[model samples]
Target: MPTTDTTTTDALAQVVAQRFTDTPLRVGTRTSPMALWQAGHVADLLAKRVPGLRTELVGIETTADNWPGDLAELGGKGLFTKEIDRGLMAGQVDVAVHCMKDVPGDVPLPPGTAFGAYLTRDDVHDVALFPAASPIRRLEDLPQGAKVATSSVRRRAQLHQYRPDLRIERIRGNVNSRLRKLDEGTDGFEAMILARAGLGRIGEAGQRPYQLLPMEHQGKKVAVLPAVGSGVIGLQARTADAPVMALLDELSDPDTAACVTAERVMLHMLLGHCNSPIAGHCVRTPDGREFHLRGMVFNRDGSRFVHAAAWHKDPATAGSLVAADLLRQGARDLINATKN
Candidate 1:
């Protein structure tokens, strides 16, 4: 937790709680179970803080909602966010909730909109899940030439670097859908790689065999670090949308936001789009003013890579500059190659 004087911002929540004692708040989220789950979490938080403040969940369709297929082809993270952003700008929704990872570093949140609060982060590691019958218990424990499934090019590329002998395959749908592929046996994936945050959020963290892979960022292991914006949930509203902002300010986690902002700055500097095989994570000191970052980029074939790090007293600029350094040293080359 961040110290009060350094990064905490609860003033907004206090004002909103005082003002909206008699009105209901309308929040917007996607129709997916996970999206609804996030909205419910926000509603619960607001309900506890503001007595008798009614909250309603407004379901909106996104690119992912209408077209659920190979996310890689349709674009991965952004597909879930664009529609909700459109809704927010159109005044159809008061607040938009999102997985911070899915919100790009270069977010164009209309002119008057901003992300008010971010939830406390969860576990930020990659997990490898195997069939209940499989003997594999870790990344290194897999047999030679084992098949692994993942929809992320970043995961596939990294897997090749560490487990070149294993075959990487693409699997789609939500977490449960991908898990079913292994049980059904048609996918033939011996194991699958998924974000630890998602699993922890949904309470399935212990069901899988997780080997914390070392992500190349500075010199430390990756388990303690997190990808840009990993594990945090963002709540956005117009800057002038005082009611929504107040509710968000009350629920916002400053430590998580500062860390995520720094991480995202790195992503933005590297021009790391959703399609790229790049990952980064940021962490803040207990005081909440100092920040450290680790950024990684891999070749599409996963044969080559680069890792870099930097520190900042102010997260906003420090994170982006660290990422810029990585980009200058062949990160851009890898991204350009993917385009070609």
Candidate 2:
């Protein structure tokens, strides 16, 4: 028998190991412009962190595709995630990227799949956009009975709290469509609410002198709290998937994960589902040594609700404490009643 070349075999082994280390990963995400942008952003980050890394975005149209009705009418759970989850379990995709806010709390993931990691968070505040020609810069500036477009229970409830007189109209479509509608006076809307992070990611706002623009498109923050998990990108992978899970861990942001954890905990504790009008936000100190969490729940009409706040060195459990406080304040009653 011919003797094997030990040096050659060793060199080949090293090459194989390096290839495994720099393996290309396929990412699953919605086909929408913002979702594609997010997946591409993740791929860029992975390329920087893992030498020779590559990725392709696998567009998955979720159950919510072309959904024109309000979430309340549709039960509001898994509309954006059911199909993506199936892709991972079927080995069609290595991982799935989700809008943290769009992920539902009441539904647990299928067995053997889990939350892998979260990316760096963006702004967690809601933004108000209005026709620049109009004087409505904020919710308070709306004229009595002025129409505003939104499908979020959280926004509707908060708006009711601030301006009960304003009419909350249901609106749907992509970011560009919504802005165009607002400019075209669709549903006679004077203003609309959108997430600041979404607008910033797409650079949707224009730079013209205020009056000439169809919509002001300013990323002006509002007083209302954000939906739990907003501005955070939720990564999902099969629990049994060591290779993909490892890659996800490499790209994860621990600080943002901690904050979102606290907020999600509150969401879980409240049993929040779609159209529940629940909101939570958490923040870590600059040193990253401590976490502060705030949670709120309101009836759909904003007739009643409860708010709670807490802090801890460990961000994960801080949300639980805040939720407990809110429960003691009768948050469950408000949420349950709203659901009914």
Candidate 3:
């Protein structure tokens, strides 16, 4: 009755002990503060999940990080991710961390690479940052024809749709640089649009004065139809790295993965790129039984647009349905118009 399977117990212990060796997992990431924060977060997650695991960060400066001109002229959002992808394929890094929105949906991922996990989604709302001395507290308080700075085409188009009179100017650089430009009144930037999650990650959300812009004309409601994969951090690794993939699988958030997958499906169906004035978002219902997807396609100027929303028990199905509805309303024409 007291006989114990000591042999099986010892074997299991050995397997667990060898799972993580002394070799540190190298994580590749961009060199920006926000990017480093994201990589550190992933490392921390992995360490917490496996007590003995070690992670070392490899900072890689990306083309997008250095390019000052239009992102469209230099390809697209992939510029932000391609270098890190190369690190993964070349075996320089065991893992690559990327801001999911910066990943292009218009083309397939680099060959031999795959995403192992999508972290839990963060705040998807867009916020407006004003100069510390500015009197404006809300977007509505800004005078007509006021200058607003942002680097996102989607944000530009949506701002035009919401307030056509406001002048949108292109601003580039990391989060801190842009904020400095805004604070210093560079190029007469009265306000700037930024993602809420980014500011929070850099400890600038509540510490700095900002307003959460409304998605639609809903009075006083804080919301925004965010870009596809806006607030998710994706873990990418070589397809053949079974051990790393297994570790990453443990960090995947099911709900976040479902929502981001639906959003990406819609973006792919729409053939969206960095310059495409497209937006999509998905969320699980309160009861967690269905996925609700909202998709929008807009011309560069935002004078014309199409919107569609749908719900389904399946995330991909919900995305496809919404994409179909948008296409039926001439979404493809809008997307093409933006490209031209």
Candidate 4:
């Protein structure tokens, strides 16, 4: 076979001369500290992906900050993203960078709005964090009837399944706030759980000895999932904006995007929301040519559960196939019973 670098080099030069010209873009993000960091990171990436692409971060507040009222009492889906979508609707921002885990499965976007691409993924496992002085070494180490703080139903269900005697309190606020509460041992929370990726992104990982996710108990390895799209940032844009979408297309990571696509398929097929006690985790084969999805559905109280796994050449169908297996194993009854 004959090989030449000239053709590839020439093609790159043409792309740079043509589509990579100077352009401006806007990114919408929430006002939380982590959200600011995310938006800033996207800004830096856009600058590198598109030549002379100027970006402005537009701060928008969403339901993530809505305290004193549970998201279940308010609206569950789209709380963190609806405001950003509004910005897109009014032409204020070109696209919104969102925490994919918070995005709902059923909400319809504006006529022109569409999910763009996902950035590179991070550690998808959740973590257990406790104060440095705390004696809690493992989840099983928590004293009987001790308080566990978290607002996520998925976490609550798994925790309940593991330790039914421990109290699962509905703790809300930003990552820092919850950590502070847990550190102070106020609200009776001896420990709290957070995503390892979230802590790492905010420069907080390894600050203390934190417990990593995919935990085990009673000599049995239990699969605990970070929320869907836990480590991936989703880009939402008006498909009508060609230049903005083109720039974002370059930012999309194929492997991360494909895995999250599989994860979302399970969430959507289950009709799950933050309030639903459902969880999933997906891993690629060593050769990177296949994906296996581990799916679990638990009753609200963790009283009943079903788990199943399957392999698929297509990441998108991996979730669907496993979800079907789970349904057959009685996931549908558990979900319906919880709904009622």
Top-TM-score structure, candidate number: 3
Instruction: Return the top candidate by lDDT.
Output: 3
Give a tens-digit lDDT track for model 2, residues 104-197: 9888888899887898888776777887567656565567898888889888887787678888988887776888788877568888888878
Lowest-sum lDDT 10-residue window in model 4: 1-10
Q: What is the C-alpha lDDT profile of model 4 across 43-132, one tens digit per residue?
A: 898776544556789998876576456787777757878788899988888889988888886566678987777988888887878766
lDDT of 4: 0.77
- The residue pairs that clash in candidate 4, if any, are none
lDDT of each: 0.74, 0.77, 0.86, 0.77
lDDT of 1 by residue, 1-340 (tens): 3334322334544566555556557688988666788898988887766655678889988887677566556765687888888788888777889888777654455677899998888777777788767777676777899998887777888777666888988776767666777767787888888888777656667765566655443333323234567778888887887767766776778777888888876777776766777777778866766787778888887888777888788887778777778877888888867653
Which regions of candidate 3 fall more than 4 Å away from where they truly are? 1-22, 219-223
Where does candidate 2 clash, by residue pair?
none
lDDT of 2 at 36: 86
User: Please, what are the lDDT tens digits per residue for candidate 3 over residues 235-302?
Assistant: 99988877677667767888899998899999889888778988898999999899999998888978
RMSD of 2: 7.3
Q: Which parts of model 2 have CA positions greater than 4 angstroms off? A: 1-24, 132-135, 205-222
Give the TM-score of each candidate. 0.87, 0.86, 0.93, 0.90
